[model samples]
Target: MKKLIWLVFACMLALPGYSQESATRGTANNVRQPNVIVVPYAKEGQDVRQLIENNPLVSRAVSKVKEEFGNRGFTTKDFVTLLKASKRNDIISATTGAKSDPVKDVVLESKADISVEVKIFVNKHANGSSEVSLELQAAEAISGESFANASYTSDKFITQDSLKLAERALGKVNDDFFTQLQNGFNEMMEKGRNLNVRIELGPNSGIDPYTEMKTGNDLETELQDWLSNNSYGGNYDINSSDMVIDISMKVPIYDQVSGKPYNVTKVRGPLISFLKGLLTSEEHEPKTKASSGQQIWIVIQ
Candidate 1:
């Protein structure tokens, strides 16, 4: 009478049982995940000095950033409210600019990111000389202001710049003002494109030899052969450095009538723990149990 054969196999690795972990859950190697930093300008008020400051340009720039982030992630807005609360004149420029543009040529300068503000002045330089000077007032002292009209419109960057220049305003470039906005927006978009993450599958599990379970180089050779034959792509990477494999066994069953022999039982167990190191695609460790269930014996032709 031919004996029945039984086999078992499992692909799980054994891990040291520990209590539940807290929010900071990770292996020892995990120091910090990836992160990104973006700065956006939030609106404050719609006054004149505050007017251009809260202008559509600033608002639109910030809006573009949020749209770019989409579902991928979230951003922390660290606006430099310093401008809103502090002195209105040059002091705001000097302290925040890291003294880069000491002359205060920049109306809005961003560093790591501290503040967002807009400048409103009748430049005797851009507009080519204006008969009336409005001084540096944030309020609308005069109606139909050319500079004010130029800045908020779609073509405002150029229109406002021309009006400002016409008034002989030096160091103040209205066209350039919005240009920085464009630059900042571009920078935000560039960063969004660079963020990425990738993952790969490592080694597989297999059976082991008895007494002295198959280990070291001997196991690797056997594993490579099986993987190449069975895998579709016939491509894998095994970590040979300090490689350790899990071992198991297999039993064959044969039919007495046809005199044909084949595998029936494949018992596998003794999960593994990846405590030592990483596993690669080429690396495969033999399983511990492959033929040790109900019927471990069967006719082998």
Candidate 2:
């Protein structure tokens, strides 16, 4: 009888263990991976598109790095394709005398969560041997905050193939390189994304920071409260005065209402609704002056 009881107790304990492991596996499988874009690093006054097109070494390095990320199951964006589209847009805009920043346009249009810039260096010796090194820097796309950086150099080889050289250099640091990026990205996923907000009073609004709204709270206080309540985990910083209010906050990756990926446009709706309650007059209605990426600008007139 004692043996039977022992067996049942052991089975009960093992069942919970198996169930917990299954739940963990299910959660991990459901976790979404971030989209990444790889681009060649360019110095000031140097065009990245031109560099990648003209320099074989740079082109191969970019391709190899992107391949590594894609092989690891990351959704990778093709920088060359994006560059072509950006260049076409620039050509179109030139007729109207409009200037566009190509790098900024590509980065924003790609809608990538992270941007990785790659730099490659090569040295050739008189003995027909070559040495290659690469640097990888990853940053958050929306906020431009750098999170991971790694540098690796390969041993001298007789081959002149830049792709092979880059592959060797990357392979040396592959484990550590991805570990850093994964940790940084995981932290970002937990903490939410960065967003910047600017609020201003229009010239003829007849309102100031101290103006009381229907809620019986001053304009600044009301806006502050709204931001605090809306921001992820109530995380935000504010700089306020009579002229303007600047707020930096963290927003969730997914919209609470739609459960879809969130962006500046999605955040603008709730903010406009809140502002409408404060500025009832049509003339004093809130208008969004800018809504792009992680930035939102509103003016109450």
- Lowest summed-lDDT stretch of 10 residues in model 2? 22-31
lDDT of 1 by residue, 1-301 (tens): 1222222112111222221231112121112111212222222222223432555443333333333323234332323343444454542333443433321222222121112323333323364432212211111111101111113222223344443432333222244433343344333222211101011113323322111223344435654555454322243344433323332222212222332222222121111222112223224432222232211221101
Candidate 1 residue runs with Cα over 4 Å from true position: 1-37, 40-54, 80-91, 95-301
- Ten-residue region with minimum lDDT total, candidate 1: 137-146
Write model 2 residue lDDT over 17-92, tens digit each, in one string: 3455434323222246778999887654456667888888788888888998988899999988877766465521
Cα shift from native, residue 301, model 2 (Å): 3.0
For each candidate in turn, the TM-score is 0.19, 0.76
